[model samples]
Target: MQKLATFIRGDLVYDGSLVSDATLQERFQSSIDPEVVASPPLLGPKGIPQFRKLDFTRDPRLAGVQNPTLVLWGTEDKVNRPSGARSLQRRMPNCDVHLFSKTGHWVQWERADEFNAMVVAFLAEDSADALDFRRV
Candidate 1:
């Protein structure tokens, strides 16, 4: 992601709240936030069971994904790092990745225009009224 950001001349917002590190453990144990009614990790370790079940580092790239793929990544996303999106694009032959700044986990909702624009353009390219993408 760092290399890609440099190449694309874009920004990468890092969220310190990611649970990847020991810091998350401390945060989760503290229960400082009033929103958390229970003893942190509302869903427990099973909350992210599938992710825990996989060996993501050694996961193989997909096959027959020749169609254009659109990836909308949130810059401040804690669950899935921005680098994951870059890696996904690297494997896919035709993928357009738009990293929305100041957004965490929900890029589409955070930056609607950019997200709409990317998807619209991709869809419009296959349509006769490609120019009407802005209206979409």
Candidate 2:
């Protein structure tokens, strides 16, 4: 549990810096919660191999998606590369891509106000609008 908490807190911030102290405290508190710490392991033997076999690039079904999509990504994210966003935008007919600079994997948590505003605006839109590419 301690190792998991450390990993999560460490991953929340970018290299050589930390998230707000309040956020860190909140993370710690949440980490120690019985419910939060009691979740089942993610990488059981069967699941581990299944996850390793999953590759979106090899799938052609992405191009068939007809719904309007919003792709939000962080330039500094270590988990998923920004190129994934670009690739999705290219494949999806109506996709808006927003890349946040200096942000890690936790875009919604790190930039709550901006993220919420973008989501609200996207949800309110009625038609398939032009691709809105912006760096926040």
lDDT of each: 0.60, 0.71
Instruction: Write the residue-wise lDDT of candidate 1 on 26-129 in tens digits.
Output: 53445555666555453424446665545242245543467767888887776568797887777777877888877766566457688888888878785645
lDDT score of model 2?
0.71
lDDT of 2 by residue, 1-136 (tens): 4554456556653542455556667767886788867873343336655755564643578889888888888888776677878888888888789999987778887777999999988877733343343321
lDDT of 1: 0.60
User: Clashing residue pairs, candidate 1?
Assistant: none
Q: In terms of lDDT, which candidate is strongest?
A: 2
TM-score of each: 0.51, 0.67
RMSD of each: 11.3, 6.7
Q: Measured by TM-score, how close is model 1 to the native structure?
A: 0.51
List residue ranges in candidate 2 displaced over 4 A.
Answer: 15-52, 127-136
